[model samples]
Target: MARNAGKRTSTKLVFLLSCAGLLGAALIADFLWASSSSHSHAYASIASNWVLEKSGTVVVPNKEKAEAVKSKNNSVDARILSGTFADLPGPELKWEKMAPAPVPRLDGSAVQIKNLLYVFAGYGTIDYVHSHVDIYNFSDNKWVGKLDMPKEMAHSHLGMVTDGRYVYVVSGQYGPQCRGPTSRTFVLDTETKQWQRMPPLPVPRYAPATQLWKGRLHVMGGSKEDRHEPALDHWSIAVEDGKALEKEWRTEIPIPRGGPHRACIVADDRLMVIGGQEGDFMPKPGSPIFKCSRRHEVVYSDVYMLDDEMKWKTLPPMPKPNSHIEFAWILVNNSILISGGTTEKNPITKKMILVGEVLRFDLNTMKWSVYGRMPYRIKTTLAGFWDGWLYFTSGQRDRGPENPQPRKVVGEMWRTKIHL
Candidate 1:
């Protein structure tokens, strides 16, 4: 674990205060920055000190440091579970483990289009990022197809979203761990299974908050490579049918916070940004290769929304901070429900704590609540909503600073029933 784990621990994890109560509402009469969370910038299941290289062992960490982690106390999670989960107005929820991925993964993203679930680029082991795509058939409950992303596509720290049959993948770290980012953008058409290159992002970033807003694709807040610089730049472009209508991206309102690994969503016609951290690692200066940041990372619970006037307003903070949950959210029954990501680090242990609550933000109450409890804690989880089931899969498991899950990186999919 890195330093500053207690108060300023890095959000090397994902966001809705770590994402999604994902309800977009405001009791905040004040214009405020939105909350967000994110995945640790495409890291494998290891501590922050180990460096991932392009040709070296990216998935495996240094053995000496890896061994040191085992000596830590394995106390069960000290965080309390909500007694109010049962009180939430929904049907009973039960979780079941589905078939695991053919390969393990972390810091990945997924999209559900029609009956197929598309699992896209991520690190297979730390050595390199996978450009491959895996498609799971909901009807068959199995992985039915596999393909590859464009060579120009980003490997990790990606900003992605779906509009109809097209998936827009935006700027992100292009190479292996902690490397420089790419300004390129690509769109994948699920129906045709083809990719089209769009005008590149004007500014490159890591895990930026990308969303499809009214008539344009909006991208905001990521980090500057080589330091923990939180980028506030917002850019957009006009697009139609998976093709860029504009030759270049246009500038928009800069986000108030460092928007890496956060969730940006539109609900009830309001645009919101939620739960992400500033500062990942400060890489050693002037190294052509990669190592680690000299500083620690910090996760937060701030939240903001864009009002009808096209300006931002502050919403209430989540009860606790969450990270590594960039896509772990779904809209159901007018509420934003998010699940499974990292929270704060244990004060004494200084190790990261994975979240176990199934959190909800109600548009009706304009409030956040624990709607359910997780089967276990996980991070970098991809989520989806289909029929009446809440589904999540693919993330790194905490190896028990408290209760651990599968002990390492995983590919298992889990779902719980929660009818509207």
Candidate 2:
């Protein structure tokens, strides 16, 4: 009985020891696994060298070499930065070419209504003012000709907006020359395909940024005669029953500073103005033109927002100074996407350089970031957004960086899928 008791005790001791050994091994393995997993997660968040390419692949370059290159160059390429640093968390964007517009044009205004897009007057191929109103049906993907806008009402550098049924155009140059600013305002009934003149703007200006807000048309700063003389007057007109009921322009708070080529839109019930040129750009010195100075055109990077109380507040400026007379922009998901525009103009040649970089501003954060580059450099184009896609129509393209003359206009159209 003693021998049997000793054997039983020994076996019990061995079994307990074996169980303890297995538990110890498991605990060590679990600790190592957890440590490795946490290390990988931490590395991913701080990986500033990685970039999300258009193919949706994350690329990590040599950290030391990339930093060296960035230091040598004054500006860093935002596209090569890591996903976390770039804040590009959305799906990959794909740009696809669409049907070309019927005629090549620039500095045109486009508004989308239902399944159709209406393109208004612009500069034509012969450098002549055009009154063509081209209707593009998104459903059929074709351009259908509409009745031309009245010859007197035809002009470029105008402010245009739509209240669903009626399109309002205000303040533009009556002729192709620089000294033809007009205060005439016209409204086009989309159903009637006819135009009716409304009360003229209180001030004669060209390219004033306009938007329809709370059943009123708000027109902001623009150029008075030449690009240098900017008008700071801001005015609004109330509309009722699809017509301008208030014939007199009601004065609102004037813009703090005036600028030409300003782009305005209403986002989150606030009026926002984007890029423009603040002052006149004179010819460089020693040029053939007498009395010329070396004053270069000043493109603005500043952004301003008007609150409900008609108070203006400056927000973070754009990534760079831009003064492109015409560009495409759309408000989606409380964010504004500004596409291709001109960033600089040669003081001597007066040639403009088109920037292909696409910029996005988050309303919640009030910060701007580069989204990506467009497929091609474009400016003075008509753009509209619908059904998760942005459509860009005819615009002028830059020939080259060395070219001294304005590039030819292109009638090509393109569409890009944007995932908010």
Candidate 3:
């Protein structure tokens, strides 16, 4: 555990606020910025630190001494500090095991609303891909069944977002092969507990990054054909007649960095795209050879921001190179918390391991500062904003024989607080 400047404390563990209520700040009314770098930049109040669970404790590390606490041994899983950024070690932040999912789920999306964690649409091993929806009550600590997807989708990139009413399930994969992608959108109205298909996107894309601003759902770059193909265009969808209607998907704004199948989130009214494979990764829509680039299938850590006016600008890159859909970003107290996601290679086994590292970016500063790593390396872990804490779901370890083989998924959950 590390200490900070403004507040110095000797307490081993503490809970400052509920996870959901911690980052309660006035949303930036507009995207404003001065000429500092290449594009428009805005300044906002930022919380000082981000807290995470390591071994069994909660730890809060600030900008001053961030590099010291990036390991599992020092990680804490302190249960009391579910979402508070306090000074504890990795041991204090690890959470206790809760009820297991009805069945093991992979490639599903989870979102929390009204104290319930809803997980939907994922595939499983042994020849089963499900659209089965499950709900976990954080308060009561119980798992309950919800509605299931009308269709079965596997390897589909699930994008979950909220407009205070329904949870939107955007484009994903389907079919026995689980290879073809679909642009059809689905809405899960928590109020009515009904699922309805929305308008299909102009182009079918899966694994597209999603965000909501001003009640509009923004779908960023995704694989146009499949997970292997990337699309740089962005689309906007709005609710009309109780269904999502595609207003228009404009490729007008050049991305701060282009290449599709990226991950994104909304914070300070700016759509930030994180790590994704870049280059001509997408096949020519109707071609068979699929596609490979003269450029290596390299990973990226660059972060880009898209404004309301569809302007693109680059932000500071992540401290390390990362690819894959294992990363998560959430806004808490004017700060963006990034968790999980692996580096380019594994350190010990020399094979890739699911990463459990955490990083926090202050929206105001536009700089990335290391938060802390998890006790175990987590790859393919689900990161979501619940209550106020950042929830990191199951991921795997890399003890395999290949450069990226022997991957295993963990069935545990961890939470941390943003101390901004």
lDDT of 3 by residue, 1-420 (tens): 354632444232233444334444322222232244214111110010001111111122232233333343442222222221211133334444556666555556667676777776565641345667777776665676676666533334666676656877777666422356777777778888887776666777666677776556777666666455457666676664346555555344545444443556777666778876553223335445332222224467888877767677778887766555523555677877666554543221122324445767777787876676555554555565655566766544433221123234445665665445
Worst 10 residues of 3 by lDDT: 44-53
Cα lDDT tens digits, model 2, 1-420, are 999999999999999999999999999999999899678644443321111101122222234545666678833343463322112223245789888888787677778788788988776742365787889887777787676887777477788888778888897866542335688888889998878889989878878888888778989888766545778988998986468878598998999878777678888888888888866433234544322122345677888898788789999998877665444787788888887766655321233446665678988898888777666666766777878887888767644432212356777878888777
lDDT of 3: 0.54
Q: What are the lDDT scores of the predictions, listed in order?
A: 0.71, 0.70, 0.54
* TM-score-best of 2 and 3: 2
Clashes of 1: 44
TM-score on alpha carbons, each prediction: 0.77, 0.72, 0.66
- Alpha-carbon RMSD of each model: 18.6, 21.1, 22.7
Model 3 residue runs over 4 Å out of place are 1-95, 152-155, 175-178, 240-242, 245-254, 258-262, 279-296, 325-327, 346-353, 385-388, 400-406, 416-420
Write one digit per residue (lDDT tens) for candidate 1, span 93-134.
Answer: 589888878767777877778777888887676556788888
User: What is the lDDT, from 0 to 100, of the residue 60 in candidate 3?
Assistant: 24
Model 2 lDDT at residue 117: 89
Per-residue error (Å), model 2, residue 328: 1.1
